[model samples]
Target: MKFLASFLILTMLTITNSITAQNQNTATKTITVTVVNATSDTGKIGFALYTKDNFMRKPIQGKEGKIKNGKSTVVFENVPSGEYAITCYHDKNNNDRMDFSKNRMPLEDYGASNNVMAFAPPTFENAKFLLKDKNLELDIKF
Candidate 1:
């Protein structure tokens, strides 16, 4: 009787663990970001995925995509449900970073997730979007 009870308990635990793992796996989804108005297809478009804590300072993920017909697209996969913001810039010079003029002005075309347009940099609150239970498609224009 003791052996049978232990076996049943172990089996139940195993099944519970398997179900939890499956649930965790299904909780993540994809995010597709498209830049709709790139000035020219001379170079790649650089994309950064940001969370609240790392907004503008560091990115959770970064991707670069080639521009096609004045548009560029990038996909971030397996992103768990949370709040996120996106920033992208057309890297016209292919220098792997956004160029700035002497007076702290951006030289390249750039935009944020919410299409925020301001003199200062975009804030986390202004550009944030919720990623819950579904994949997202966002179009940004510059």
Candidate 2:
């Protein structure tokens, strides 16, 4: 029947559209961060990725990369499009946290996205960058 044929065609079209939308929504890209100028390549590099709500307190994601030839490269994959900030420090002692001096300044080398510096802690807005449906490359220096 013509009615049956039409119904079948419409159903197929709906299913195809749904699949396309899902693929679009799930598309993601990689964020590559290269940390350079490390004081030494003796320890692991600890890094964190932050969003507005989780800045400093909690990282949406965290990673550690081997320090190689006085440099390190970290990657965050499958990242959805949004605003983000990155912070990293050298864990020379392998204790997994940044060291501070008696004056409360950092004792270890550290860097952030945009290489932002502040008298106090830096804000997310100062270092935030947008990631769309494409790969991003960033470099931070210690």
Candidate 3:
């Protein structure tokens, strides 16, 4: 029956399209971030990936790596491909947070994406990056 044949072909095409879309949505992407100018041991350094809204998406582990005299790396595993911003600080005092001066100035050096920085507070847009299955290197100065 031609009707049955046409129906079967349409169903197969629909299923194929669905499978393609699912694969695209579920593919995992690896993003490697190499930090420079860090002064603390790798584990002591704090690194976090954030969404454009500034909410913490994930925290990077130092066990996977450690910052040398002034360098470190974090490989975000299986991250869904998307836009993200990186912020890292050396917790020299192990306070688990960046210490700021009484004037709200960052006592310890900090780095953001694209190194977007200013005398005033930096915005998330300054550090945005498009991740698409490739390694991105960023430099931070402390």
Per-residue error for 66 in candidate 1, Å, reads 0.5
The TM-score obtained by model 3 is 0.73
Instruction: Give the per-residue lDDT digits (tens) of candidate 3, residues 60-96.
Output: 3222336686787777667777787777777777767
Task: Give residue 36's error in model 2 in angstroms.
Answer: 1.9
For each candidate, give its TM-score against the true structure.
0.84, 0.87, 0.73
Candidate 1 lDDT by residue in tens digits, 1-142: 9999999999999999999988976788999999999989899999999999999988999999999999999999989989999999999999999999999899998999999889878888999999988899999988
Give each model's whole-structure lDDT.
0.93, 0.89, 0.69
Per-model C-alpha RMSD: 3.2, 1.9, 3.6
Question: Candidate 2 residues 1-142, lDDT tens each?
Answer: 9999999999999999999998987898889998988888888899899999999988988999998888899899888889999999899999989999999998888888998877666678888999987899999976
Better of 2 and 3 by lDDT: 2
Query: In model 3, which regions exceed 4 Å deviation?
Result: 1-10, 40-43, 55-65, 133-142
Using TM-score as the measure, what is the rank order of every candidate, best first?
A: 2, 1, 3
lDDT for model 2: 0.89
Q: Which one wins on TM-score?
A: 2
Worst window of 10 by summed lDDT in candidate 1:
21-30
True-vs-predicted CA distance for residue 83, candidate 2, Å? 1.2
